[model samples]
Structure formats: structure tokens, C-alpha cells
Target: MHTTTSDTAPEQRTAAPRHPVARAGRISAQGAAALVLVLLLLVVVRLPWAGDLGMHAATVERLRHGLLHPGNPLIDADTPSPYYSPWTLLLGIVAKLTGLSVFVVLRLGALAGLALLVTGVHRYVRTLTAHRAAPALALLSLLFLWGPALFSWSGFLGLNSLALTVSYPSVCALGLTFHFWAWLTRAARGPIGWGAGAGLGVLWAVILLCHQFTGVVATLGGLAMVAGARPARATLLRLGTGLLPGLLVLWLWPYYDFFALFSAGGDLEAVHRSLYRDLAGRFGYVLLGVVALGFRLRRDRRDPLALFFALGVLMVAAGGLTGHYSWGRALPAALIPAQLAAALQAVSAGRWALRRGWACVLLVALVAGAWTQAGTLGYVVRRDALPGAVAAKYREPWAGYQWIVRAGVRYGDVVMARRFPARQIPAYGPYTVAPGYPDVFLPDADRREAAMKRYFEAGTGDGERRAILRAYGARWVVGGAPAPWLHKTAVGPRGQVLYRVAP
Candidate 1:
């Protein structure tokens, strides 16, 4: 009897190793964030949206009038340049065929890409979240999206900021980033894993043609991870093989460096003073939060993949600090992992708060605040933030040109305008313009300005507009609300205006 107590076996405990799917799938941070993403997406779907409207005006002007792009010649020719992507041109072609507004095409395309981005982000967070996070994760996902992707191209500074924005044929490179990072972290499954990588390579190539900045940043991100392990050549080859097609597409502009293209210039210091300040200021916070997070997740952070979330956050902070503090370019690339982590933490915190009582209120408050902010941001971007008009116009500039061609004028007649690009004439309609400024397509800015200016001045006379008409073969003069230069003929409701010259 006495021996029985001493010899008694301590309770036998066994745990089946958690299946990743079961772990990730069973209610996670990602699910919480994804819920918000879906909600925001639904709102983004319906809209009379516009952003970067002027760019579309410019692009459509060229396409509708068949004017060549004065700046870059590669787009005008069938042989694409590595610097110039065929995607926008193809979009223009499709818009012409479909009779959709160039803005419409672009806005719709961006919207679609955004939807996918949210889904991908949700998955990204799910891949990274360490435990069952459905409820909290769903909320966190919503919060993170509003701050990053949803607002990437919206508000004061966001993604799709036309200046830093890039696109390929039908995709926005940034939109697919979640999936790109997600795959690297996911336990590589069969064809699905391979497929994701292959697909990413294709999308990344398109990203280069569309928005080289984000693409470069993303590459930097992935490269940082790759350098750590110095993985086998086979893995590298797989990534390269999948990328070959896009690489060939990108090589279209061989003149742009295959290397040094992404390097910060020598004056990285002065070129972006504000960015540096912002980045430096945020560095403390970024380091504090991300590194602390690295520790918080240390028990589960055994995998190489975890570094991505932390690294992504830090890199974004770096971008904000170094570049012009462009939210699209600097923030999202790094915030990506942070966002994913936040969602998981929120959910984890939520469950803890529920169990722990009032002391957890502060923790839960942070979670709630973060989630609400994300949802609110998403709602804002979806409802009003994105210059949908601006984005569409930038994506397709043919709309701007259609006004010029539709003028009740004869063929072979020219239009007088200011700062109108001359290259898109061929794509737009049977029209021609003089003084191809910014004719990088031909040579350099000097050549472009010289040629365009000569053509512009030839037809104008102070005493008589007729002399100018005769010189440039102009049959009509046109202008729009956005173009204040044209006096006599201003654009109407249809976005066109025409002035009669000497017959």
C-alpha cells in the first residue's frame, strides 16, 4: 500500500501535433481581418470613383487621337521597351474597343485587384498567426487593411498614389504582395505551392511594368529573406524559372539597368529630406513594436517565415523615412507583416481579455481600437478616399483625347493646346498634333521640346488666329475645364470644345 502511492504513474498526457490547417483555420487573427476586408471590398465594388483623373485625360488624349507619346517611344512601337509596359497600352486598346471610359476601365481594374489583395492579406495573416484567431483575427484583418491596402492609393498619402503607383496589364503589383509573402511562409504543399510561386513571378513582372517602385521594394523584401538561409540553387532556380516569362517581358527595356535600377541614388540624403525625417522619427516606434513583437511571438516564432512580418514592418518604416514618406511605397511593404501580426495579437488578446476580466480592458481596448480604425479606414477608402476618378484617368488617358478628335473638324486638321502629349494620336483616332514635347520616345526631353515648340508656334499669330491655323493645319481649337489654356473653345458637358478656324 505504501509502495503503491510512491510508484503511482503521473497522469499520461499526449498531444497530437497541431495540424497547421487546423491551427490556422480554427478562428484566427486573419479571419478577423479578412472579415473587415470583405466588408470593405463590398463597398469598394459600387462607385462613381475617380483618381488621378488628369493622367487619363492625357493618356486617352493620345490614344483617341492617335498621337504618339512624346516622352517614351517604346509604347508607340510594337516592340515594347523594358521601361514601358504593354499593359496600359493594351488597356487603352481594350477601352477603345469596349467604348468604356479609360477611367472606368482603370478604376474597375484597380478595384478588382484591391479585392484580391484583401483576400490575400487575410491569408497572409492566417499563415502567420500562431493560433486559433477567427474572431479576433477577423477584426484585426479589418483594421490592418484600412491602414494599408484600402488606403494605399487614397487619402493624403496612400497606395496607388499615381506618382509612385505602378501596374501591369491587369494587376496592381502591391495588391498581390500578401500572396507573395504568404507562399514563402506557408508550409510548401504540392502544386498549389508551386502554382502560387509561379503566379507570383508573373504578377511581379507585371508589377515592374506598372509600378517599379513597389516592385523593387517588394523584391528587396523577398531578397532580405532569401539572403538569410542561402537556400539551395534548386529553390532559386524554381523561382527564376517561374519568373522567366515576365523577365523576358521586362527585358523589353534593356536600357534600364537589370541592376542599379532599384538602388537609391547618390544624393539619397537630400532628395527626400521629409521622408528621412519621418522615417527616422518612426524608427524608434517601428523597432520598439516590431522587435517587441518578435519577442512576444518568440515561443512560436521558430520558423524563418516569422521574420517576414517583423522585417516587413521595419522595411516600411525605412521606406517612409528614406523616400518621400510615400505611404504607398514605404508603409505598406513593411506594414504588411505588422498588420498580419496585429490581427493575430488582437484576437489572442481578445480571448485573454474575455477570460481575465477588467484588467484586460486596456488590452481589449487597444484591440478594439485597432480593429475599429481598420474598419473605419476601409469604410472611408471604399466610400470616399480613393480618387477613383484620378486612378481611372491615370490608368487610361484616352478620355482626354476623345474630346480633341470628336471635334467637328476635318481630317488632317490640327488642334492647338498646351502641354498636350503628341504620341497617342495613332491609338486614339486619325489625328495629328505638332510639337511633340517630352519625346523621350524619340530621344530626350530637349528633342521633344524643340520639336513640339517649333510645331506649336508655327501656326499662331498675334493679329490673326488664321495664320496659326494655316501654319499648323489646325481646323479647330479645343479645351476643357481642366485645360484653362484654350479661351474661345472650352469643353462642354461632354468634355469637348471646338473653335472654328478659317475654312
Candidate 2:
């Protein structure tokens, strides 16, 4: 299939329009991007509590104290974990050398991740179109092209989601994924040397290790880039040759077993089932991008964006049908190409009438999207201080387990708490009786969870509860109920009490 001029262009041939309206629109998009970037910077400094923040923070804390043999992040177990990726290891090193708190290191990581994401988006979009506005427009589209319903997940690049998970390795992996695509697009156009190919392969593996779900999205995007290029036999050979070292890195990584995650899918399906819920409410706005993708398909039978969208769709659909709901994490692979296509089409459409129509439609969709996620403002601003309208949109963050930590919980001390508190307690350097999140590598996670449950059960005798605490060596407990074996030490913001387990 013949490539479109927009795709093959080495640089933007047309000077930016001097028309007042066009200039204004470009300025508006760029301004919106700048504002969102500033908001994200504030969010990083604030580091609001949300999904997996504690898990990630705990991982960094463990690594800071003991990089070589950092045990399971959430519980008192000497087991390897998937959380100790290259990204976290680097942050851990920084924390150790600088004597920075784990949260401070996380703030730095968030800044780096946000920077990578911005630069990567600009570079990748430039490959798709020469329009000067394409980069800014694409960035805005990626952030605001979803449906009116609010949705936030690690790999999903929606503005609201990015604000919540800016510190996560998933964000860093996604940033690298964009840069990978841009580099691959350039290399596939001509001969690639062995060194470049091998380096590319290593980068790919690093992304997977950082965040396995985003890694799948990266793979799909990379395949789309390669398939669309139809590279020469020698180019293909070099690419395949480079892949070996990358696979080796995955196999040899001492932190965790990268390959074991495939068999571990059964453990994750339950937690990920929500990825399939309210699909239309969460992603319906992407139909505009889908329409734009249709245009690209009509122009080039093997358009990279179309191929990327198809591959993502196939994966997500198979997941929903085959009961492998975890594959829903690959939703970004489908959403991203369509979003970019819409942004590119707005500027590159051949006819003036077509361009005007598409741009206007996109503007409306983006405005609606921004409004839907207005609650994100609460991350940096006080909810009570925000305007009533914005306050209503806000979803409050967790108050955290600092109250427990402040009362003198120390590293490696196991605390018995139910699930919610279990999630946050470890962030402050203590372990919970049960792992707050799924732990594929922890051998006794299930038994630990059952013990925690039985301890809290109304019918359980004090003897069994004490046995449970002793079995896990739990030194503290977070609950309201009083027991003869518990000595209350501190009360939490939500009225939960911290108790020292009597010896």
C-alpha cells in the first residue's frame, strides 16, 4: 500500500497559517497542554493517594534499604516481586544516595515520567504528520478524547488518570513506548545497524519489566509500525537479531520471573474484570477517532494507525470473550492510534471544508472531556476550597496510614489490618498480615489473607486470633474492636485504633 504524503513527509512543507482563527485555535490547544502539564507537576509534588501508590512507594522503600534482596513489598515475606522493575531500582538508588524519603523520590520519578511523556508524544506525532500543530493537538487528544464518564487506570493516558498515576512505572513505560515507536518508524525506513537494533531490543525489554501491561501495548504499537513499513529483508533480519538480547535480559533479571506472569493470569482476572465494565461510558468518545481512522484506512490499506487499532481491538475482544480480562490493559493500544489519527486528520485533511468540519467536532469533544474530568482539580487544590461545582466532581483521596506510622510503626513490623488499611500501611515502612495487592510470587498470600479474615470474624475465639497474630509475627493491629490481647496505642482519622499486640 502506498503511504500518504503526511506519513512520508520528512518535514512540514507548509508554513503555519497566518489566518487569525487558525492561529487562535493552535494557541488554545498549546495553552491547554501547558496548563495540564503544570497541573501534573503540582500533582507530583502533592502525590495524592490512589490506586497502587502505596504498593509503589513500599517497593521504593524496600529497595532503598536493601536493593539486592528487597523482599515482598507489602508483607513480611522474603520473596521476589514483580514490583522491583528497573525504573523503581533507579529511584531506589537515588533515595539511598540522597537520603530522600520514598515519597520525595516518587515525586522526582513523576517529574521524569511526565517529561518523557511530553517529549515522546511530540516526537512520535511528528513522524505521523508535518503539521506544526499536530503535536499539541495530538497531546490534547490523547488526554481528553475519552467519553464523558470518568475513567482512570495506570496505562490509560487520559488526563485524569495521568494526574493520579504520574509516579507509577506504568507512566514511565508508556513514555518509553512512544519514543520506541518514533525510533522504530525512523529506523524501518532505511538500513538499521546491529548496535541500534540491539539497543532497541533492550529498550523494549526494559519497558516490559517496568510495567508488563503497558509492555503489551508497546509490543502492539511496535508491530504496527513494522508491519506498516514492510521493511527490507536485511532490516527485518537485524530487528530479529536484536530481539535475542532483550529476551535474555528478561530471563536473567534477578528481581522477579518475567515469564511466570503468563501462567499467573488466573490470579489477576478477578481484579481486572472491572476493565470491561461501562466500556461505552468510559470510551465512547473514541468513535470520533475511529471515524478518523476509517479515513486513514481508505487512504492506505496498511496504515500503521489502523493496524495498531485492529491489533488492540483483537486483544481486548479476545480477553473479554476468553475470560482473560487482564488483557483489557491493552486498551491504550487501540485508543492511542485513533486519538492521534483524529488529531492528524484535523490538520492534514485535503479539503478546507473537511478540515474545518473535523477540527470543530474535535474541539467540542475535547471540551466535553475536559469538563468530565474537572474533578481532577481536587488533586492539587483543597476540595472544600474549590468551587462547589468543581468540588462535586472531586473524588477524595485516601487519608493514608500516616496516623499509624506516626505512632511508631517501624520497618519490617507486621501489622494486622483488613484490606483497605492493608493497602496504605506498607507505604510508611511496615508490613501487613496479608499482601494488599495480588502477589504471584508470595507462596502464602492466600493463607495469610484467610488468617487475617478469621482474626476479624465475629465468631473466632481469642485463642485463634492470638495464634494468627503469632503465626505471622504481627506486632501491631489496626482495628476498633478491643481484645484482652490488644493494647490501644493510637487512634486514626477515621476512628480506627492502632493496637500493640500483647506478647
Candidate 3:
């Protein structure tokens, strides 16, 4: 129960004026943050389609049906998958016990993750600064400090990204990461019992098991915390002791080999290339935070935020230089520390005039960032109902393959689809001939991809197409054309046809 307080520096203790105007500003900031959270809650309830929603839902479905040995999440194969994370397992249990649909379970998970994120931010910020406004400012900065291109990725914690991926394991992992740092901050500063150390280790493992990429960010943050504290040898020993349980958990996780992923990076590097694109448009605004980080480093070379930022930059730069784009997932590590530093600098002890000026600049930047991501409103509102300007910001989510489900595609049925539809069909219980996403462990993933390609190729013979269908045991095919081997079952939106594989 030992909790860390904001005792690192005198600047952290600076208090805002008790003047009514200043008080009003603090209340307003908190209110704005609350409003944003409410908006996100509405989004969770609506559950707008984007990114990997289907994959996550498919994971829950698999676990709900067979928790102990849920096979491949997307394809009809008996293979372990990385998507079978601790968070998804819990959701699966809930889905089974309550008999709730996977999407409903996902909504509940999103709410839980959002709550964890909000509370974790509050707790972690308190360990950094005592200013009442620091937590709210930090939360706002974290959400709105990115550049204007509206990048939305799983591990990226920007407002648009979080809105789209609030239900993902990455969000839960990030929330847990904040709590881990808060606990680590206290443990590093003072002594603790062995039990506490072991618990910390378990928590670390859970975060890693929840989302591997976010786990990297968490690891970097932990290292920065310990390095900055210059803890006693006893403290470091306890930390080392804590690490054992974490590694054990990683080794024993039954869903997939966590350690094997290190060598599996080759398949992921190509898909993650997008993380390195449009640097200025996607993250240029964070430079303001980099400026703040510079100020922290000047005050104390061992500042945890400064060290955190440096480590993140090194990892991301190394990834970009070495063609290891998967490492780009760690961008949030650098982005987060910088964002928090900017917020802290705005509220830290300074000349009244200087603080006020910094606050104004931050406020303007936040507003601009918010505007850039206004498209997030599309999730909660009808896109057509929105004004043309707002509608323009909206990125349409996929219409989904539920139509085919209505056409009698049942659980365990194999469906042949192109990559895009394949990504979505598995969410409803049916499996794709090939996984829509990358699968490093699936030994025949290349063969499956090739077979799917041949089946769809214009020059493919009827005999070869039938052979491909027979090889994968596909019961249904989703495409625009009908062949002699296909019996048309149903027509979906956008001229999509669902055809039964004629036996």
C-alpha cells in the first residue's frame, strides 16, 4: 500500500493561485476532460468499426467457445495466435458466463479500459507534480499533443487513436503501464517487502501479455524510472527479484510463445512501415513537448522524463535506420514523456507571467490538435447528419460482413475471401481461408495466401480453383463473380456476392 508522493523536486510543489479566475480555469479544464471522456464513452457504446475490431472480437469468440485451447483466431486452423492475450481471455470468460455477444463484451472491456486509463493518469501524474491542474493538463496534452494528420494506431495514445482502439488490448496495457510506473516510482524511492516486489513483477508480466508493443514502452519507462532514481543497491536487487516472476509468466503463457516474437519481427516489419511515414504531419506538434523535455534535462540530467524520451528516440531511430519498422510501435514511449513534460512545464513553478504565457500557448496548441481530429465525432454521430465540414473529417468505417452471416455462415465454417473481407468475417464465428492479418507462427500462412490468390486469379482454371477450395475446406466464397463451382447464396451491399462452394 506504500504510494509515492510528489517529492522529487521543489518545482513540483508549486501551487496555482487561489484567485477565482485561476480556480475557474482549473474547473474548466477538468470539465473539458470529462466531456471528452463522455464523448469517448458514447463511442464505446456505439463501437464504430475501425482497425482490428474484428480480430479482437474473433479472439473473444474463440476463447468463449474454448478457453483452454482456442485455435487460430482468424483462420480455421489448429494453431496458437498472438491475439489470445490475457485481456481477451477475461473478456471471453465474461462472454461465456453472461452469454453476451462478443461485441457487447468488447463494449464492456472498452469502458473498463477507459476507466483504467483515466484513473491511472491521475495517479501517475500525482507522483510527478502536486499541482491540482497537472493531471488534467497532462491528460489533455496526452490526447491532443500530436500533429494534424490524424494517425490512429493501436499503441498510439492520441485522441483519435484511443477513440478507435479503446477496446483493444493496447489500451488496457497502457493503462496498466501507468499504474506500474506509479508503483515503481514509490518502490524505487524507498524499501518494500518481497511480496510487493513479486506483485509488481506479476503486474509487469500482465501488461506485456496484454499487448507486446505497449510492453516495450512500459519496459523503457521502468528503466528510466530506476535509472533516474539512482536507487540503493537493495532497491535494485528487489527490482531484479521482481523481474523473475515476470519472465516466468511470459514463458508459461499458454496461448503463444511470448519469447518467440523477438525472432518473428521479420513478418511484422513490412506492415509497420506506415508508422514511420509522414513524421511531421503525424507527430510534428509534439515538438512543443520536446522543448519542455529540454528544460527538464537542463534542471536535472537524471530527470526520468528526459531519460524516457531519449530511450524512445533511440529505439525508434534505430528501427527506422535498420528497416525494423516493428520497433516503430515504441514511438509512444518518446511521445508520452514529451507530452507529459509539456503539461508539467505549463504548471510548474515559474514566474507568473512566464507560466501564464506557456499555458496560453499550450491551450492554443491543444485546440488546434483537437480540431485536426474532429473526425472522431463521426464515431458518435451520423456522418451524413454532420455538417459538410465535419463530415469531411470523418473516415468511414467498414460496412462489415454481417450480411453473409445472415446468409447462414455458421461457426467453424470456412469462408474464402480477399484479405479485407477476411479480416472481418471471422468476427462472427466463421473462419477465413487465410488470416487477414499477419501470422508468424502459422506454418502454412504463405501456402494459404498463395492458394487464396490462385483461387481469385483471372487466369486460374476451374480445376485449380476447386482444388484450392477443397484444400482449405471452404464452404463459402465472398467475391463479385460466380463460377460453375459456386452456387449463389446471397447478395450483400456494394455488389458483394456470397456463394456456396458447390459440392
Candidate 4:
């Protein structure tokens, strides 16, 4: 059924292109300025490159290959994931268009950029609250100083945990925006719009799959929004419907996977081990949010966004105080609501300070503080944003994991490596790993292959290696040095060792 605009003359259709509100155009400049300021303040948050460590890179690479032949085992089917289809579908489209290898880093660049855009969304959402925009922007400015700055030298860069730490807030911001939008429009009697619903669904789904650790904060933020609803049943429907995409993944978590951030017998213990470490990384963020929340609640205390944001920060901070801490990674999912709430307060503070005639002094202080903290922001930006730097890093010799572009790795062979190394290869279904040759193959800790370590060091006999290569199947062994059979050696872009073991 074709629908026309009442078949009215196209010229007579004087409907101007829609803006969220008429003032959006005027405010857009301010919003963009805020975003750029946020982007620039923690300019280093962009980082040295878009973070293409091991598995993250490998997943994109495998997906790239899978696009060419879906059923073909470019990567295996039984990898680990919750089957969150939407983001994976988006990733697949990206893989088909760009291929997996190049996308290894390419995708991270895009992801980091997406993370950065949260500042803009934060600004836009702040616009709704009106009075809170300034401090909200300032708070965002300060947030750039938190994770990346603290973690840049925390010695955990290139690790999944740190990546989760940084990316969680970005995801949280998006969730908060959607939740606020949903609550703001919940009274609409006409068909409840799908725009906010679909958008929130997609973003949260991506967050769930990206790393479940973010669950700590994002979940908190989500509940805050639900609490804002007028009718309990409607709110229940909204929240439940919103989680549909994530539910899909939870159902399929046993089978489909991109990386195993969460799995039985694996690093589940690591999550416990990381408790205090996570708390320390997130201390500054929690503090700032608390202060910002205190200030924002001073005025329009009734706003649900404000209340939820305050509660979340207090809750997480209290948890930290009482040793429930984990950099809130045990709760990063709460990051969205908390930050949104903080942003609301921060913007309010900023506006008040500015309107009260302290705007110039405060803004300068904000920028100066961020600039001093450039070490943090500069890492992510310098890594990938610089021209040719990303490509150059991957071209041959590299320092950080250079955000490189490649067709993708073809992993149809056995891979032999250590605990961490074994974990990184799950995305490549085309390969298996070995230690004692022929018998013990899987290196997954959860897989209970006790002999995995010995396999990497001793599995490389000339004839046996040839036979292992032929029988078990493998194209490359990364980050490991073995005997004569592990032919064709090279260091990875990130300086991890690699061997082009023949399939």
C-alpha cells in the first residue's frame, strides 16, 4: 500500500525538515561545540589507535571472512556469544563491505568515535532539561579525565577489561538518552513511537555483546528510566520490550559468540579478582558524578532523570565505599543513567555558574584541567585518528595495536598458544590449538584441556609438525615461538609473535 502526503502538490508540501524542536538548530551549535570540547578536552581518549588488540581484531577479521561464505568456517559457529543479532548483523554488514582483517582496527575507530559521540547526545539530552546544560557539559568535560587518564598508565591498556571500562560509559550515555526520551514521551496517547524503542534496543544490545561487564552501570541507568514511567504496566512493557534484543542474545549465548568476556569456568574468577582494581579505575568518575548530582538536585529535584542519576551515583559510590567496588564494572551498565543524571546536574551547575558570572573562569578551568589530562585523551585519538598512523602501524613494525586495514586472517589451521592466547582465538572457528599433538587440542581453560601449555612449547616437531599441520588444520599461530615446524615467523602489528604455520 503506497501512502502519499494526501497527494498534495509536492511544492505545496511546505513541511520544513523536522528538528527535535525548533530551537534545536540554534542549540545544535552549542551542542556540537560541547561535544567537540568533550572530544577535545579528553582528546587523548580517542587514543593512540582504535584499540585492535587480539580477539577484538580477530572477531572483525573472522566476520569479514564469514561474509564471503556464511556457512564456510572462516570462524567457527560455536564460538561464544548470546546471539544478540542486531549488532552482529550490523557487524556482518560492516564485514561484507569492509572485510574482517581491515575492520579489525577500522571497526574500533568507528566504535570509539561512537563512544565519543555520547557527549553530543549528552548535550542534546541536557538541552531538554534546559537549566542543566552548562554544568552537564562541564561534567562531561571532566569525565574524559577519569577512565582513560587513570588507566592509560594503569598498565592495562590493550586488555579487554580496560576496554570495557572505557566503552561502558559511552553505552550508558546512549541508554540514558533513550530512557529519558521514552519517559518524556510516555504520555503520548497516539501509537507509542518506535523511534526511541528501536534505537535504545539496538544500542543496549550492542552494549550487552560488547562486554557484559558494563552490566553494573547500564542496568542501573535502565531501571532508573523505568522508575520514571507513569503507569507501572506500561513501564514494564517498555522495559521488557526494550530488552528484546538482549534477550535474544541471552537465549543464544551458549552458541554464537564474538568473544568470551563471559563464560563458565573462564575468567568468571577474574571478575572477582578485578574487584578493587575496577574500583580504583573508576574512582574519579564516581566522585565527580556524586558532586555533580549533589549540585543538580538543588533546583528541580523532582525530575526522574535527576533523581535516578543521583541515586545511581550514590548507590555505586556507596557500594565502592563499602567495598562493593569494581570500578563499577560490576555495574558499568549503570553508567548511562548515572552519567545522564550527572550530565543533567553538571549542565545545571555550568549554567548557574555561567549565568551567575563565573562561566568564563569555570570554562577555562575545565579546559585547562582536561588539557593537563591530555595523556588520557590523546591515546585513543592519536592511535587511530591521525592520518596514515593507523595504516602505518599495521604496515609492518608497530608499537600499540595499530588500527590496520586487512582483508582478514584465514584461520583454517591449528593454533597453539597460552591461556590468554587461546582465549583470543575463539572468533576464528577455522582454527584449533594444540599442546601434546593429535590428542589435546582445545586451549580454553574452561575446556579443561590440562595439557594445553606443554602443547605450545613442545608440539613443533619437523615431521610431526608437518603431520599436525596436515591433520589438525591451522594457518597461523600468534604470540608463540615453537620448533622447526612452526614455519614463517613474524611479529604482529602489536608486537605479539606470529608464525604462519601451514594448514
TM-score to native of every candidate shown: 0.56, 0.97, 0.97, 0.60
430, model 3: CA deviation in Å? Answer: 0.5
RMSD of each: 10.5, 1.8, 1.9, 9.9
List where candidate 3 sits over 4 angstroms from the true fold: 1-11
lDDT of 4 by residue, 184-295 (tens): 3342212344455555565565555544544334455555544433334543465467667656655554324534433333233444435446554443444545554555
| Distance from true location, Cα of 373 in model 1, Å | 8.8
For candidate 3, the clash count comes to 0
lDDT of 3 by residue, 441-471 (tens): 8999998998888889899888888888898
> Model 2: residues >4 Å from true position, as ranges?
1-15
In Å, residue 261's CA in model 2 sits off its true spot by 0.8
Give the alpha carbon lDDT tens digit for every residue of 389-496 in model 2: 889999988889888878988888999999988888999999999988888998888998899899999998888889989998999999946899899999888688
* Model 3 lDDT, residue 271, Cα: 95
Q: Judging by TM-score, tell me the better candidate of 1 and 4.
A: 4
Q: What TM-score, to 2 decimals, does candidate 3 have? A: 0.97
- Tell me the whole-model lDDT of each prediction, alpha carbons only: 0.42, 0.90, 0.89, 0.41
C-alpha lDDT (0 to 100) for residue 448 of candidate 2: 89
| Span of ten consecutive residues with least summed lDDT in model 2 | 2-11
TM-score pick, better of 3 and 4: 3
Q: Is candidate 1 or candidate 3 better by lDDT?
A: 3
